[model samples]
Target: MNLALVFESGDYVLIGVFLVMVLMSVVTWSVVILRIIKLYQAKQGNTAAKQAVMESASLEEAAKKVQGMTAPIGTLTADAIAAYRNYRNTEAKTLAEALPLNEYLVSQIRSSMSRSMRQFDGGMTSLASIGATAPFIGLFGTVWGIYHALINISQSGQMSIAAVAGPIGEALVATAAGLFVAIPAVLAYNFLNRSNKTIKQDLDAFAHDLHVRLLNQKD
Candidate 1:
């Protein structure tokens, strides 16, 4: 069928649906690529932060290594060091005398991890909404195409390959387009969500080690 025939009836709705699908596709890809990059950087930064802490002779040296660092692991380590120092410096107490210092450091580290998880999960809700609604939106276009074809058939009293194919083809394309937009969205959401869970586990583990290291920090 010629493409012109598909546009003969009320195709504005189809065009609108196509535009929406295109918009959804663009946003979905943008989120997927950006989040993947962020997760990778966080993972690398976490490794670098762990190495810096383990190799340093003192917590102060570790803090220097992570100074000005912006990654989640780096930030958490830096914050813990700061919290420990603030507690000792303010109370004029040595590390041995800072009884609640461990608890305070753990609380601060947990807060940082919570913030990191939230950051990692940014834009997930939008991805989910796109996945959940794209197919229905596409289906709406298909139903309209079929309805438009039926209206033409009823008006002209004809049903030939040429007469029926244009609308049916357009409807099928609409349905396929819907699935096309939705499939990637659903996959990305699931994959990224799983990656985030793994990242949170890593962060929690780092926090435990950091707390122990801070407790052993020297003056």
Candidate 2:
């Protein structure tokens, strides 16, 4: 009835389940690391681009200055500036005349921001699904183990600790493996969700700033 002996006698399928759980954990960690790096880079690039845009003399000047830069923030800024320039060139004098144009332009910028957000959020859904399902998968394995153990017990008519220990140990190991896979995956999913929210907030702020600048130009 020693734990070591129980494990040694446990089914190999249970060990395989534990190995799969470990692999899932590794994959989840890898995704988290990659996403963190990407989000950090995008945030830094966006801050720099926003600073450059604010410091520029005019929308056209800002566009020209940031033309070569490629980041979600930079692209949004460029689109806003271009829309404003196009509206001005058409020389629509009244606020009513320009409002529609401004709205259309902002819509374009918003759509671009949304697309970029989706790109940044890649692989997060899969991670979430894995987090939600891994424990259940492990549970399924445990149930299978337990069923087999009970069958062996019934057939052998030996209800002693030695007869029941190995299968029970294997079943419990599946539960442990399930937790090992699920915990970090759930944490990563939450972290990425928060990060996405922050990014969306930054995009919204940028859009509002652009709208304010356009209104000031009309004044």
Candidate 3:
């Protein structure tokens, strides 16, 4: 008659819907928590690394300061320095090395940026997929629940409002559950996306400055 009773009397399909929603919710929160921690650490480390690079007198000094750093800036600076060293040290230059030093450094830094960005991109696709699909899955459950409710009413020959309302209301819970699962996923997706965009801007700026500094140091 009530929500509990509806669930208690529900068949496998209804229970399956509930289970699926629960799983989605668990996955969503797990990703949200892990990503928050990751981005926070990355942002903090990157800030420090950027400061170190900005304050340093030369690329070699910056490399020494940021050595073993896991953040994007560290990766970019390390890769740039390594490439520059290799370009200078190589006795026989390959065809790829035929490119101007600036162009070659730009290419290497871009690759490093991509690698760093990939670390932040983990779980984003899953969040997006859940945000897009959860509502529909819940709606399907609601429809199925209503079908079950109507079947029970027909068998009981119950046409009264109370009898109809209880099961129908119970069925509506599926839709509510769907929204409950989806809203958080969608919100998290947007929030994390914005956070990543900010980090990307920082990476782009750092890359340009790093390139320019490398060029200047070369000269």
lDDT top scorer: 3
Name model 2 segments beyond 4 Å from true. Answer: 1-16, 88-99
lDDT of 3 by residue, 1-219 (tens): 355665597888988888888999999999999999999999999999999988998767988999999988888889999988887778798887778888888888888898999888888998999898888988988899899899999999998999998888888888888899999999999999999999999999988988887787753
Tens digits of lDDT, candidate 1, 1-219:
353444555478987887899999999999999999999988888888888878988777888999987778888888888888788778576654365876777777787778767888788998999999999998999899888878988799888888787667867677788899999999999999999989888888888877887788676
Candidate 3 TM-score over all chains jointly: 0.95
Residue-level lDDT tens digits of model 2 in 50-157 = 899889988678888779777678888877777766676776465533567667666767777887788787879879887998898789778877987898899989
lDDT of 3: 0.88
lDDT winner, 1 or 3: 3
- Preferred candidate (lDDT higher): 1 or 2: 1
**lDDT (0 to 1) per candidate:** 0.84, 0.78, 0.88
209: Cα error in model 1, Å:
1.0
Would you list the clashing residue pairs of candidate 3?
Answer: none
Best of the candidates, TM-score: 3
